[model samples]
Target chain A: MSVTAAFPSRARAWLRGLLAGPLALLTALLTMMGGALWLPEGAAGLDHLVVPVVFFPMLWAGWFLYACLDPRLLRGFAVVGGAALLQLGLILVHLMAAKGAVT
Target chain B: MIKLPKQQTQSLLAVHGWSGVLLGLLLYAVICTGVAAVFAKEISDWSSPLSRPSGQELPTGFDAAYRDLARQVDPLFLHEVFLFPTAGGRWNVLFHVDEKDAKGQPVERGTEFELDPKTLKPLARRDGLLDEIADQRRSNAVADFLVDLHVRLHLPNPWGLLLTGTLGLMMMVAAVSGLFLHRHLFKEIFTLRRRGGLLTARDVHVVAGAWNLPFAFLLAFTGSFFSFATTIGVPAMAMVAFNGDIEAATAALTAKKLPEDPSPVTPANLDALFADARQRGGARVGFVSLEHWGRADARATVQLEAREGGLLNTAYLYSLASGEFIREQPFLGHVPSTGNSLVLLMSPLHFGNFAGVVSKSVWFALGFAGAYVTLTGMLLWTRRRQEQRSWRIMDRAVHLVGYGLPLALAVAPYAYFLLRDRGPHPADTQGVLFLAVAATLIVCAAVADDLTRYRRRLLAATGVALAGLPLARLASGGIGWSAAWQQGLASLLAVELALFVAGALYLRLALRRSATDEATPAAGPAMQA
Candidate 1:
């Protein structure tokens, strides 16, 4: 575990961290976009739920991941990350109860 | 083509160059004047004598004064007009009387009267400070010219929107590419070393562009969104999803789904609703919407939400009539989880109209910075290929449009203030001012250029026109600039003074540069080439 040896790995890690941000936002954008053909069928209620049910949770999760991936932004970002997953889970449950497509 | 080791910088330069040229001249007008437009209301008030009194009224009986506003407003228009307890509300209230024409909605004539809220009397108005030099009535003439210019570079509407929208995309692409190209994202943060002439200018473009990338992104994104909402977004959304159901799509985007049921009889008192909203909101009731204003299902809901401390945030709305409070549906805040929240945050983020004075100021500063980034990029673009054969024509076009733009902006406020006294209505004043400024810009674009022979003449003409603004003020018998100032005409005075100062500086620099460039053959080749 020489400091000199660790330097290359640290640089690799930092590079990886920087790339993660854009990747997260991209993933979120894709997930939201993926719901294009996802117009709720029989129940008109599903329509109201489209943005709230599908779009937001992905965006939140993406932003959360984006935040946490930054080492300097690590401290509170982890809590936000955990909350992001929690929110996603809760949103999924809400969507299911509302009879979303995934359900 | 010159090759450089930094592939990314070249890419960024290309992106920056294209985007800048594509939208620069027009956006410069928008930014140059928007620097003043941020304080538009103040500038208007300052330039227009009709809005205020000769002296500030004591606040001792302010509530009584506000109540008096009821008398002046025809009960129907009251909903449209609000009296500021102070000078700082969004806009001043004057009853704009609408005269009906044949088979159409009543045409709004002009501001008929300034209602003294305390007395409810239409005050005997004169063009105060704003008009002492420039017309307050046409204040937006200054801003609107820039806005129209920015969004569409004085091109026709469709063309303007298309160009600006393209520029917006360019801006976004530039930002992304810029971020990608900068390997040392923060290491070069303090790398600005101001050098001679072009290099100094280049450094400025780089530092400002890099440091303000986020702000640039947000401003451009919002700007593009704004222009696109009308030009592209609404149309695209309508065609693709709703089969040109613009109204339905707009309703979804704007209005929270309200019930068809009426809430007339037992509906709560509208006045009481505001008090209740304020009580709930604590700080201020930012928005109030009535579900069924005169109907029974009208549950006046008010939000007791907190200030959104970060981006993509806002949450607060109240019932207009019943003083009943409502929760936001969901999905509004940066932390959107509901419908109510979704709608609430839209405006704040879109307009950057929230978060107190500091936020608005920051938005204003960044907005102009975004505008500068666009302008400097245009200069760099023209300068980059100055040695090429065809570039002379292009350079002339860019510079002609560039320098003349700020002149257009300077002329607009003057147009506004100058025409204010003569126009019967505010609308007429606005119309006259806009027509004058736009006509001038087109004419300038047509005749003006950056010819080495005609350089002094062109700059001198622009400078003279700018300097004439002060003379125009005095010639109009400005109720005396001193009198205008004494009458609490600070806004009018301040803006006019700034305009004059800018005009003087422009004249000085233009004259000096023209003379200096003419004297030295060595400097001549460099500048011209």
Candidate 2:
């Protein structure tokens, strides 16, 4: 491989690693925090809180593994970033509703 | 085995190695202490035993003793009360009220009575804030030291919990990526090459890692859940649901609800309620908590030990005013559900206390192996890069922590025994001693010429320290072996004997390592990668 060709490849690899490492972690955290709001409470009314807390590790692990194994870096970013944004939106919506109710 | 694309497999291999290399030392520390802490209850009993076993955690006259103590406690702090067995089979009765401190932080100011279960007489009394009173408990100092190290590495508040939780996640990542990287998993499980250097070491690492992969994953998942659930999950949920009111969030999850009826009314006979709970649950009661005692809405909750071969225990609720039995409920919620069941399962799966001593022994061995794999994995990584100056520094660190942590842990109990009766704050003294030993080890690691020699010497010191523990205990007014035997304190004697045997084994290994001339570099040039 020529040096010129390898430079671009190396840069791309660095970018992919960043996305898969820290960005993936942020995505998992956002999803967990927001997913709790949308998840349905079971008959006992505690599932929404208890289930997410108990399975947070698996949630993060799945996202982390997926971020690493995905062949296309762009797709990984799109999927992870999209999920994060969706959850963030849900959280904002809930906060807005709560504020309105308080007012 | 599952097959993956070549590129994907390589990616996972990098993930596995980097994850292990990054947090491997801290994870090893956690696992090592955790293995010892699996028998923390036994350690407490062995270190500080009553004249007799007390035979039961909560004795028959507990109700009377509790009532007497309740009469003496100030009514201002009687909003809640708890009765549980503490170290050395002593029953602790705590009456407290949650009040905001000067900084507006919620804290429990309470009175605690340590009563001898056999005699139903108060052995000690403490009145202060809950945290301050907790610091004065010296009987369980040794076990608490080990558990605190394992759970949080002695870091304060959420930081220690956060670090251990992150280590748990790192272990999970390593386990998952390892599963993917090893294509011939079953074939490697039985393979151990007889080569004398890195080949043999790599083989051992692979075999042990392969065999422990599932258990490692299970423990990591459950352990992280326990750490994060308190530090992050509850508060985050509270923020979203209760506008950051933790108390309200806890009440919702715990299913605590009562109509406001604080009218003065004497509570009914707690003895009858205790017997009813035991009869209904078909298990021994482990803990009892009464809310709003001596009030019209007083409620008592009794937690029971799980029955033989059962995974879950029943918690009975009673109306203390009428002495009527309420419905039995699960630990977390008012009714049995999947979420409650999963949360309940996490304790036994992580602690391995589901089946008593047998299960605990298995967990201890497996946890020890997990710790071994972590140490060797780091050593292999560092040894492969030992030529680089930075990597050489890391190599020294790996050796220091790998051998020095066990030495520090072995030294802590000595401090506990020596300072327990002589001081008011033995736990603090023990902590300081632990840090001093660790610092000394680090300095020794820096000065030593041969890393291998340093490891051996440290191991031998640990062995000597462990062997001397029982003598120290006996010298410090503990029960002698003959007395322990006559009193049927078999568990205490067994722990003493086990520590002696373990010490002897470590000494033997260290001596054998000293006799060997194969102190060659950990990994050969070809293995460097």
Candidate 3:
């Protein structure tokens, strides 16, 4: 195969690898962190924190499988990246609000 | 079976095989060690037992020892105290204060005392950071070595944990993919061909893999939880929730809140509390934690083993001053909730210690099957591509690790038994010897003309090492079999006999393989696989 013909396929493969590996991990972690903010704090006021940590493996696995199995690479990127950004934004907002209240 | 399109099936197969090929060796090591680690307590008892059997019941005079140690240590170190049993039912009392180190990381600076459960006499004492003190331990070195290898492959913290956790993820991928890849998973579970060829090799691997899928998934998920809960999860969660204070985050999740009254109040007798906990829990106390000792706000939490047939542990909270039972404690939080229940389930599920020896035995066998599937899968993968020189070399590397690891592990106990007393720390000595044997095996594998001979030699060596371990123990002051039988040291006898039998079986198989090799060199690839 010519270089130009091979380039797109190789690039797509590398992108898929990145999405399935590191990007998926980042999304899982961010989701876990954000869970403490959104998840209900049960009677003990720790359900949100404890539950997310406990279910971390499942969350990571889910994201990883979706990343690997999804045919539309752009959709995979959008869903994972969008969820990660959403959580990151929520975390920053929570921190900022807490800081404002403190100030 | 769950049906999927051809393209997806191919993707799943690729993921399954490549994941095994990439991380299978380390995963196999983890699973192999984990099989032995199921009997860690038995191994500890077998390696180092007291003259008399120390039952689960906490020995008397424990309070007196605690009081003596309390008076001896600085009051600052009395912020918290932990009491648990260690090798051979010895009481390990650690009085420590949690403090930040120079780098602002949490460290427990403590004085540890190991006491004889029978006499309550201090066998050893060390003062330092908790990790450092643990490094100096000897009595349970062999068990600790195996558990450490299973958990982290003996690498340094964070890195070792991360690597193992990643391996757990890989295992999760492999299990999930294998499940999706197999169209006849149900049939394969019961289908094993006796025909001696590649077909039988594939059948064995598939059968074992199919039967072991759920267990593999369970182990992988729980193992990953344990590995990452502290390393990544706790730290990241702490960063968000507790301003990077892991201790504070841990306290919020696990610790019970009691009103502060710092005025000195005499603590209640530990023996009475232990007995009460035993009666209430219907099991022996496995761990005890004392917070704000000798103060009005002091609390003692007694964690007991799972009740007669239960899967979850029982923990009871007590007021240290009055010695009155406060409540039946959940693992996390004060009351039982979804989170606490899930967290409580993790330990028994992962360790398989809830049902005692029977459960542990089942878990060990399943883990062994998992290891077998992993090894056979890799061998078959290599065998299929053996026409290439690189694949042939991969075959040798696989054999070296697959057989050499067991050989090294079988030989490790020799160092522990020999140097356990009147020598350098047995844990360190075991590491050195394990590495030495592994190095030697690597060289042997490199120089060997035939892979079959090298594999058989390793098997024979492993057999000899295992068979001789009991002798080494007996020679190095271990109790005799007669004494063990008389004293009802069933665990010791069982472990020793198991080792000997396993060793003898390996020797027999090696000899048989040698005969087969002589009769027809490379007659059956199934045998090699």
Q: How close is candidate 2 to the true structure, as a TM-score?
A: 0.95
Off by over 4 Å in 1: A1-103, B1-13, B49-142, B151-162, B181-189, B192-199, B234-244, B253-269, B282-293, B297-322, B328-361, B421-497, B511-529
Cα deviation of B188, candidate 3, in Å: 1.5
Q: lDDT per residue, candidate 1, B132-157, as tens digits?
A: 31234343344454444555666777
Task: Indicate whether candidate 1 or candidate 2 has the larger DockQ.
Answer: 2
Q: List the residue pairs that clash in candidate 3.
A: none
Q: What is the C-alpha RMSD of each candidate to the true structure, in Å?
A: 11.5, 2.9, 3.0
Q: 1 or 2, which is superior by TM-score? A: 2
Q: Rank the candidates by TM-score, best first.
A: 2, 3, 1
Instruction: List model 2 lDDT by residue over B1-529, tens digit each.
Output: 8899999998898889889988888999999999999999899998888877776557676778788889998997789988887777888888999999999988999999988888989998989999988976777888998999999998997999999999999999999999989889999999877654434667878898999999999999999998899998888888877888888888888865657689988898888888888888788788888989989999999998887788776788888889888777677778777788989899889999878999999999999989988988888788887678788778888888988999999988887787788865766887888899999998988887778778778889999988999998998889989988999988899999999998998898678762332332332232211
Native contacts retained, all candidates in order: 0.00, 0.71, 0.59
Categorize the docking of model 3: medium
Judge candidate 3 at residue B353 and give its lDDT: 95
